[model samples]
Target chain A: MAEFYSLRVNGVDREVVDAQLGESLLFVLRERLGLLGTKGACEQGECGSCSVLVDGELVCACLVLAAAQSGRDIVSIEGIAPAGVSTDVQQAFVDAGAVQCGFCTPGLVMAAHSLLERIVDPTDTEIREELSGNICRCTGYGRLVEAVANVAKTRIALGGNRG
Target chain B: MTVSVPTSVAEAVSLLAAAPDSLVLAGGTDLMVEVNAGHRSLDRVIAVDRIEELRDWSISADRRSLTIGSGVPYSLVMDGPIAELVPALAQASRTVGSPQIRHVGTIGGNLGTCSPAGDTLPVLAALDAQIHLRSVSGGRTVSFSHFMTGVKRNSRQPDELITGVTLPVLPGWQGYSKVGVRNAMVIATASSCLAVDESTRSVRVALGSVGPVIIRCTDAEDWVVGQIDWERRAVDDGVVAEFGQRCGVAARPIDDHRSTAAYRRRAIEVLSARQLRRAFPNG
Candidate 1:
């Protein structure tokens, strides 16, 4: 018998079906929900390519079971920016040219969003530490660091305090 | 085909006792990794992350003991007042995977996994921490040393879940060091944790990844404790060399892809001496 679970994705209630016993949330989102923004790379949790926010906590989607996420709120990278509009972090990534191959961009952006949510004005060291789980083969992380730092500076200039 | 998310400790205990085969899930860091790698099979998972009762934490009335929730995240340990309580644990927590891993990984997860290379295992062993287990039957506490028996094996039964961990509010300096292939997001090739109790003038050291289970250097600990009066003698070239050799003898490493037994043996000496020196700066 197939099991179904209710999940809140991007503030919208959705019924996820055919959540097999061992199917990962990454597979369900990409295969079922068609949320391809959450890439599946290194299916092992080593690379943060499948990062997502489950109940406001960033976790490797590849490591989370779809069944385990029942009744939980999940935010994927696609939900962060809506209708051709990019978030400040995403904009910073573009301005800093942090995207190269772009395979790691979604995960990096999700991780950066999680970091910025907790820390409004993060230092260079803090940003690096927060995104250490994310592995990017291309661009060597310099622009990514600059991207997060740029958002931090912008938030501070806008009179926002670091959480 | 039962999935239970108990809101309280009592509820969780009751559910666990009802289904002894139920797999307890907290943080799901290690379990998820194994499941993803096809190393684990699970049909019944009991999520304990939301049970507020097990997440309770408090300092003992005497201020000499601290009881921390088993579900407390390592990131919390690295951030707040809890870090001050156990600096070695905080340092070890920093070595766990990375920020996201620490943010989600719980100390209970580390204890439940019972891996020798677990960043917090050696520190818990050096601190002589206690594991608090609870079931529908009742509650029982065991020493960390006795709780862990082998690699990834523990005395905890399927019907029981870890409630919390308790350790004496240490009254001295504690240090932890890990030698891994990389500084970030890497497992330890060999790790050592050393704690110096000035109140009792005792020193305890535990080594990880060099044995089937985390091993303590009783001889070196005793030697350092005995030489407290002779601080200069304790740090002497001969004493350091002897301590290192004894630590190496205590390890029983195996040749794996991460490293060879020979390399791990040598690393035990170097890391043990370094941690000991850091803990006993005067020596």
Candidate 2:
């Protein structure tokens, strides 16, 4: 068995079971750390359900090894809220009625949050492109796109704050 | 076995050379999928993401070529300095999977995976890109044509890790096109890339997912180049369509779940024609 290590998740340091050489980050998060907000859908990299932020870059946790994340800051959907109400992106999803079926909402929120981090004022096309990896079976992505765009606009209007 | 995350190129090379059975993992976009699907069997994995040396990218001092780090992500290739140097490659990179996949997937991973449907393979084949490989022993370069062996296979030794891909900086027009079920996050049914060199009065066309490896349509390229009267006439639609048909015929596709051989062949023809038109719009 490999030695366990301390990992920074959502700014909190927690010890996690050391991952085997090839164990995916998704498995470690869901199975080991019990961070269930990061869903595991289509273990294949196609679906964005396992999406997470590693050092601020959006990556498919299902496609990345847990060992590769050493010394990196990881942010999962569970980490999105430190206090209470969900992140602005999550709130926008509800306000825009973009949460349908809800399985893909966390992934969509994480993807949208990643986009907002890079571009506070993303165009509709950019938002669509960023969210392309995330699949929303119920909403058909019409409202999801709107939600992301709305969040981007709100972020910019608030001088880059969701508060 | 424990995974080794080497921080430098030398460390990575040493580790790989020491344990020839260790697998090199960059991006892990393809490898992880294979492993999770039980398609690949491996006992030891070496994570290459932390190797800063492999991530170094810069143009040669001569300014006659571009050296792209094997670890550079597809997103960087699509929007970074490499885009200006190799527009066709950038265009192809843009069509790989989606933004998330692009953010993590590396061109080196594409080469290492060596899939016939690799979006960037056709462009590299058409551009005659060179792959730089290194091991504890030393370094050597191989042409794109020689690097890939067959579907999901390559000639790279287990101990050798790709360091960079070098593409010559030349003045020419290039175009790439891929046919898939949908516009986003779909693998290529068939793809083609075309490069037209007005100075040499030559053209190069490479097709993917239509054969075991990216195939060059030398006969059709020569035929098109011979027929083009660059100064007097433009390349007509009929000529372009004929070129596309010839390029399509060069492919040997097989029926698969994603698409049928017939559909892939037909798509090859259309993609070939469209790419030629885009590469040589005036002709």
A1-163 in candidate 2: lDDT tens per residue? 6657667888878787655656788988888888888988898878898889988889889998786677899999988887576788888899999997889888889999899888888888888888989887899888998988888777778886776
Point out the worst 10-residue segment of candidate 1 chain A by lDDT.
A154-163
RMSD of each: 2.1, 1.6
For candidate 2, give the docking quality class from DockQ.
medium
Report the lDDT tens digits of candidate 1 across residue range B1-283: 5556777888888888888888888877788878877888777888888877666678899988888888888888886777788889889999998766776788898999999999999998998999999988889999999998999999998889898899877877787888888778889999988887877888888999988788999988887676555444245556666777888888889999899999999998998777666655564
**TM-score for predicted model 1 compared with the true structure:** 0.95
For candidate 2, list the clashing residue pairs, or say none.
B235-B283
lDDT of each: 0.84, 0.86
Model 2, chain B: what is the TM-score? 0.96
Encode model 1's per-residue lDDT on A46-149: one tens digit a residue. Answer: 78988899888888888776776667889999888785988888888999999999999999999998998898878888888888889999989999999999
Clashes of each: 0, 1
Q: What is the TM-score (0 to 1) of candidate 2?
A: 0.96
Candidate 2 chain A, run of 10 with poorest lDDT: A14-23
What is candidate 1's CA lDDT for residue B115?
Answer: 92
